[model samples]
Target: MSRRPDPTRRSEQSRQAIVSAAVDLCVEIGYAATTIEAIAARAGVGKQTIYRWWPSKAAVLLEHMTRVRETQIGFPDTGDLRVDLLAQTSAVQGLFASDTGAVWRGLLIAALSDDVAADGVRTLLQAAVVEAKGRLATAQKTGELRADVDLDMVVEIIYGPLYHAWLLTGRPLPEAYMEEVLSSVFDGLRP
Candidate 1:
């Protein structure tokens, strides 16, 4: 007799298949066109299987992005605030220049219309903000930034314009612009 397949392994396979299908469909059809039905058909899974594992297509696509792309930002601690900000912005610039950025653009567009998708996007961004906040606090402690500097405001000041360009203007986040951003933001924060 053939050995029984492990239920856990089977479940994981199904989960991955669903995620992969969701991403592929989103990429091929655009986020607005990709549906749970299409993802199920593409993944060779039943509708219930996807509904059981994810609340919505947005949720699945959110997981897909997290698993399929390296969206995590590692804030460098070069001791110089300008250096660290440049590295962080450079990484953001590189991400926006890649295929993953196309997916992100789709996701953001979907989020604008879908509240569930908006929440998912907010959650992902909030997690990154939490991580970046720690680094900013460290910089403040080290006297690189003024003790009175508001870390939250500092983060927004540093990254908000890049996101604005990414989301609205559809412009590239170039190194020169990143340097200009840092120079402007840091000018106010000097200890």
Candidate 2:
């Protein structure tokens, strides 16, 4: 007889599949168009499977964002704060330059108009900020970042222009743009 499968592992795998499917669906079809039914279908699970785990499509999207941050955005400590900061920021910039980035931006804009989506977006951004601060803390300890520099403020300085250019101004985000932002940021933060 075949061995019995582990229920806990099976459940975890299903959950992951659901989240991954949700992310892919949200990226391909805008978040507004990605339904729980579609995510369940893509994951090869039933709609009840998803409904049992998440309250709504927004919840699934929020969970997917958390997973992306955990898996895709690994921050490195290269001893050189500038290199580390650049790498970290560049990783984020690359994400924004990707197809999923366009979807994420659209979702964010839609969130602004939908209260449920807005709450999910706010929670996702808060989690991202926390992760970013943890990475910045490494630089602070290395004495590369000024002790007085506010991590939150620095994060805004690094990301604000990119968002403005991509979302508000419809400008292209060339690598040179990121390099310039890094140069200006490091110049102001260097002790």
Candidate 3:
């Protein structure tokens, strides 16, 4: 006889489905046009099921973005600061070029007026920055970076342009652009 599926496991599967549906709908239809009823129908669950776990449609979108960013964003150490930064910046470029990028932009738009969405974006981005800062601190300790360099400022110098390009300038973040950004930042960061 086949073993019965665990209720907790089933519940988790349903939760993942809902989050996935929310992200897709948010990207395909834009966040404002998406609704709890539509999310339920897309996820093959009832509207009450979504309400049981999340307070609102925005909450579901926030949770979905949290899951995506946690798994996809990271700063890796490759011994050389330039190499490490290149890899990190390249990953950022790739993320902004993917469908998730559209969802992220949608979240940013939602954040302009919604406190919950704004808080969620702020918290999620802060976590990513914290991880990158740790890598910068390690480089400083190793003498790879200037001892007096401000980690927060360095991070902003590196990532601030990427966000600006994505949101304000609408310029392409290609490999050549990543190289130039890292080069300019490293020129001052070198000990």
Per residue, candidate 2 scores C-alpha lDDT tens digits across 1-191 of 89999999998999999988877887787777888889999999999999898887777767766666778876677787667767877888788887658557766877877776788788778877887788778777877788889999988988788788878877777887777888886878876
Q: What is the TM-score of each candidate against the true structure?
A: 0.86, 0.79, 0.90
Candidate 2 accuracy as TM-score: 0.79
Candidate 3 ranges beyond 4 A from true positions: 1-5
Q: Could you tally the backbone clashes for each prediction?
A: 0, 0, 0
Arranged by TM-score, best first? 3, 1, 2
Better of 1 and 2 by lDDT: 1
| Model 3 C-alpha lDDT per residue in residues 53-149, reported as the tens digit of each score | 9987778888877877778777889888789888888888888888788778888888899887888899998998899899999999999999998
- Which candidate's TM-score is highest? 3
lDDT, each prediction: 0.82, 0.79, 0.87
**Full-model lDDT, candidate 2:** 0.79
TM-score of 1: 0.86
Better of 2 and 3 by lDDT: 3
Error of 3 at 166 (Å): 0.6
